[model samples]
Target: MNTNTACELKWGMLCAALIFLLLGACSDKDAIDTRPSYDPSKPVTISRFAPDSGGVNTQMIIYGSNFGSDTSQIKVYINGHLARLIGVNGTALYVLVPSKAGTGEVKVVIGNPAKEVVAAGPFKYIFLPSVSTLAGFTDKDGRTAIVDGPIEKAQFEEPYWLCFDEKKNIYVLEEFRGMRFIDADKTQVSTRFRTGNGLDRPRTLSFNTTYDTLYITNDQGSWTGLSTAVATKADNFTRWTSLIYSLQTNGGAAQPQTGDYFYNSYSNGAIFKWDRVAKVSKELFRIGDVSWEFNIQFAPSGDFAYIVVVNQHYILKANFNRETRQLETPVHFVGGRRSAGYQDGVGIDARFDQPHQGAFDENDNFYVCDIFNHCIRKITPEGVVSTFAGRPRTYGYADGALRDAQFDRPMGIIYDKESGTFYVADQKNRRIRIISTE
Candidate 1:
């Protein structure tokens, strides 16, 4: 009971009390949350978004107010196309742009009852290239006919070649059937010509610069001597006039410039320049044997010409001499000769299975319809080959986003620079598919 003993006991009791208080405070499980609480009554607001313009799959962050942390209750749309909600924190939302979300407004809907908020300005969505069926039955029942009318009711059998006239009207050559016409609106299809006398087994077609004349090649045997013919708009494309009757098997044709009509003969694998006015043909170059089926295409600038040797599974690149107006001896550009498979690489490292027809875009990128591979290929100016649309060797009838789309034996393709669109002739599927940015 001494003074020193009492002072020590009081100090020890106070210290123990202080430690217990500290432990109690530290052991408390409930922690303070700094997040702003979401109120159901408050309206959701979208103030703005970063990188307002972006293509499909672009991860965009939207800044706003009164957004709940629960993403399940939130939905975002660009141009009326639903976007995938990735994450949401009360004040911010993360979303991925969906396909076909063209330039348009951004809308956000939140809460159980749904409070909608539209951004003050459009998101300026960028379009990603996608493939969709322009025409044809998507069923794989092997049913095909020549019935033509509105796009939905229209039918095609073995559509091979597609060409666009000056009026943007499309001409499709069917194997057994003759010619099918598609109006610019893409709303209707009509039988322009039927397989008969001057035009049997039409193989390929091309329109003159003026689109007044259409040249179509026939697949009759070389001995038939009636493979090259022309149909004019003046005749309503009803009759074909025999341009020549040589022993060579005509495969395809192209008009490199205003007055130059060049065609390939499969029998000799020789390309011939035909003066449409005089009907005289001159040899340009020969690259293969009798087994080759060639499709010719010129670059947008006419500086390069590509020969897609169908059976050979390779592309030959030739330099077009602007001054002399002649194609130089072609060199192996992309794909491997006789070495066929589904592969993507640069130059000869690439592979193709029955690469048929191709067209050059405004950017000079060449797109080829790889028939047996069942895909469309893109070849850059640097000779880089990649699958632009359709899965390799996977054939069927499907319409959707480019990579997700399917095609069967696509035989020909042409690009429309005006609209940045590509038209594909899905041969075995008996349909015309289109690839566009919109």
Candidate 2:
């Protein structure tokens, strides 16, 4: 009885000890962390972010610590909106703020455990006024809202093209009065100069900020009664008749001295660049076979130039080589289809009748005056075209919503990058019309 009892007791004790050991091992393994734990003491830190205030899609750099080498583990948020992560290192991260992100705190999260670090100061999401549509001249009545001209006198009678300087000063070209200048605040007006020397009609004006020069394109004949004569006399009458005048911010000699200038001949549809210093003129390109080219404009980026073919009722973009000052073959960017109706669509699907001039806004959106349609159309960078202002073929002197506002014939337009405003030459209305955000 004693031997049997002793053996059973020993085996029971051994089995019990084995069970206890097994449970202990399991508890230890459960307590051990397979993944590295974030240290509370060495918490993730975000020191700062560069360009703290920026608009949507702005690239931003964040400086921090413990952000891990793998960018895939890093997630950034600006004002609670997920930002597009571009790159990251252990100490810094590159990200693009989400479009339309509001002003709020910037947060950076790292690791599978998801440790988050917030910036010291809130990141400001700058909001620019979205100008998808036009609101007519911010005045009581459209007809009497000439900021520069006399209340009774139509100082802009036959205003053709207009532009704004960096300081927001305006320069307008008039068929009868030539060039007029208006101050930034619109309180002062000055008649700077007039076109002469057989250039009876000034059609367009271009400002080259790089060279600080003003280029004028003039037609040799009048549009009043010499349409047939202009067609026949074309090249001979308008050849080398354009002017290039040097511009001064202050009141200097703003005269056209006939130096080497670049001009467009509407009669023959030829574009020539003249070097007044060299006394030589070289023909760049011609669209005489297609239609008469009316206006030529260099992109604000200086990467391309757009030419408006009035008779063809379309616009063409020519790739310009800045270093060589040469233009490549032109490509149709907008309004190739010849429908005189007011419709907005994508690229060639949109129709423009007699697109007289074109201008580029801050975001590179191209705006054109659809002369016959009597409206301004905007073409996006992605080739989407839409009517931005004025009613289709509707003429009146009212001021309000762009669709409700009437323009007799808008021939020219220029955008103000600083204020996000557009000054339009309401040709038949005989006044300068303004398009601005509400």
Candidate 3:
């Protein structure tokens, strides 16, 4: 037991201690990783969604995070519902929280993976109440209204169409987002209607006042993500072409987008009309492959209709009395080139590069939002077109007026007929304009 044996014993003891220490370190690290980290310095900072602002989708100027970095598919949750969390950063995420509910609170739950909610809390205050429709499409006069939707005087992301039932409940129809409702006071209304479970592209809502029914059509083009980087696609539109849904309160028929035009991309690319009373549908008319028809309105006459197509495609009109139904043969409601070196030779219609969406101005005229072109066009029923708003440039023009300014993709148009006020969904600009016509 002299020097050699004693030394060996001591060395062996040291090795055992080191092994124990390593094991303890590893155990501690595992526990720490699994522990809850629901704290963030600043959860979400929002300044854009303030009241009286234009419509908002995913393009929110938000600041917050438990988000480490690389936000590809940040599925934010409000309370627990999937509010779209679009672009992301290490400490910030420009997410799309749904239109504010009447009284419910908004909480952010980030879900990119199966990981636990890194952070969840109420967001900036939202007071947007719901609008209900006594009849699906309320067109008393030039003052067209949706009991649960816009009143020809709403703005972007405002419910374009709203419907209601005998119960006095109102339901709203969103472009790519789904349906919501309101009570008598216009508080948020909740229904089973969904937003993006089966949309291939941007969608629209058409109601039949005659039958107390709803018609929803999805384009499938936007969801392809083949468009530009700014085009907003729906999560539900994995491969959806169109959807035909019906809102029959109590116990009514469930309608899916079917038939020749239910979800078909054929016959001039138009959305079909569903007869809620008859439970039958037919091809209403084709709006083409453009994303502009996301917001549609039937004329106060209830006999005519005008729709917009994306990117210089066209803003078309339909004559229900006529036999031949095409894209209503767009008369260049507004047209221009949005991209570099874009050219349309010989024809005025050729110049329209990226026309986003539009709605009707009171006199039954059209307000066509020409995105990237830096202007909106005023079109007549017979196809006479004029610049309605904005000017030539890469940005917005004049403060109150829609002057030349930067616009990514202005998607929705909300109009108020009473004041003759117009709100453009200047998407890229992330702003809404309040324009009045003379």
Candidate 4:
């Protein structure tokens, strides 16, 4: 062949060889080892684990070698249950302890090849004890004791009333402190709101769950909102004593909205419904010649409201017509005449001496703080009255069995459903007393 022809053939051959070499390089790269390999001599090993003991859903870290960074290829088991792997690195893995996992060995599996490694010691699953009853409260040593303070900073000076919101935060009415908010744990305290408007001597607070509004009654005879950001004010009462919100009506144009609230005037013995939207107060009904209304609470059924007649030493169960905004005749449910004594029986047979505040438990059982009698009393849904806490006629700061425990004029009382505990504002003791079976 001519020199030019030979040069062209050589160029084509060189191009073919170049293509073959490129194909080989691509194949080698595609076949590169992606699967992690384990050595029999230097197998996967777990050195230790941080926070080897924790409750369910708690995150823990595992320290080891040959864990491999691929999360999907790794599995972690706490006590036989597979733990959720949150992250994984070559030498460590993070996981959440599985719910219902018991205390046992923690195993880490590296890959489908199944190189398993276990820590030196087993991990522990912490299960919190369940509270069974509200019979009494005790300390770590199992001795009867008060759970909350007399700490100077958290002490209350005549805490008149208290109520819990949906979040379980407590709103307390301190005679001098205006309104204070205590967290569920009671570890932190905060002021719910502050306003230049007279909230002096706030006596009672009622929360409207539907509107998230708080209706407060003070000695100044004014109804105000907890937050100044909201417009809630109704003045001109002789003396506002107790406050509570009406239940929401499902049907009927004439029925009051869920935001409406009611308060009783101590001086006039009149109950007034305050329209939250219109910011107006209208008298609903008046108890004949009755004086010193202390506490008012609506039953969960929303059929009737129980009012404490402080001077009468009885609880009046008043039925209200949501459509007409009128209250029917009130009945003395728990006590009889104005005589003050310590006695437990059915309905009118029971006696109360200066009952202050009242609350209801999950079972609809009504509880009252019989201040003068120095005990907490419970009135069943069937109208059977009994002393639930505090020794009758016994007054001190001692804590023990209901019959042996002494309370110094316990006032504000509230029930916490979350903990199944009753928190009492032991007014004379200047401390909060809790009753529970935790």
Q: Which ranges in model 2 have alpha carbons more than 4 Å from their true place?
A: 1-155, 195-197, 210-212, 222-262, 288-291, 337-339
Q: In terms of TM-score, how similar is model 1 to the real structure? A: 0.71
Model 4 is weakest, by summed lDDT over 10 consecutive residues, at 247-256
lDDT of 3 by residue, 170-220 (tens): 444454555544454433334334445443233444333432344444443
Residue 399 lDDT (model 4):
67
The candidate with the higher TM-score, 2 or 4, is 4
Note the Cα lDDT for every prediction shown. Answer: 0.79, 0.62, 0.40, 0.64
TM-score-wise, the better of 2 and 3 is: 2
Task: Judge candidate 3 at residue 272 and give its lDDT.
Answer: 49
lDDT of 4 at 383: 90
Q: After superposition, which runs of candidate 3 have C-alpha atoms over 4 Å from their true positions?
A: 1-196, 199-202, 210-214, 220-271, 284-297, 322-350, 396-398, 402-408
- lDDT tens per residue, model 4, 152-191: 2454555557777667767666665555567765666555
Quote the positional error of residue 215 for candidate 1 in Å: 1.1
Per-residue lDDT over 192-301 for candidate 1, one digit per residue giving the tens place of the 0 to 100 score: 88887756677878777677787788767655567788888899998888986764554655544754677777777888777766768888878987757777777767
Q: Please list the Cα RMSD from the true structure of every candidate, rounded to 1 decimal place.
A: 18.6, 22.0, 21.2, 20.4
Looking at model 3, residue 373 earns an lDDT score of 60
Model 3 lDDT-worst window of ten: 247-256
Q: Which candidate should be chosen as best, given lDDT against the real structure?
A: 1
Q: Highest TM-score: give the candidate number.
A: 1
Is candidate 3 or 4 superior in lDDT?
4
Clashes of each: 0, 3, 41, 0
Q: Which portions of model 4 miss their true places by more than 4 Å?
A: 1-153, 193-197, 221-257
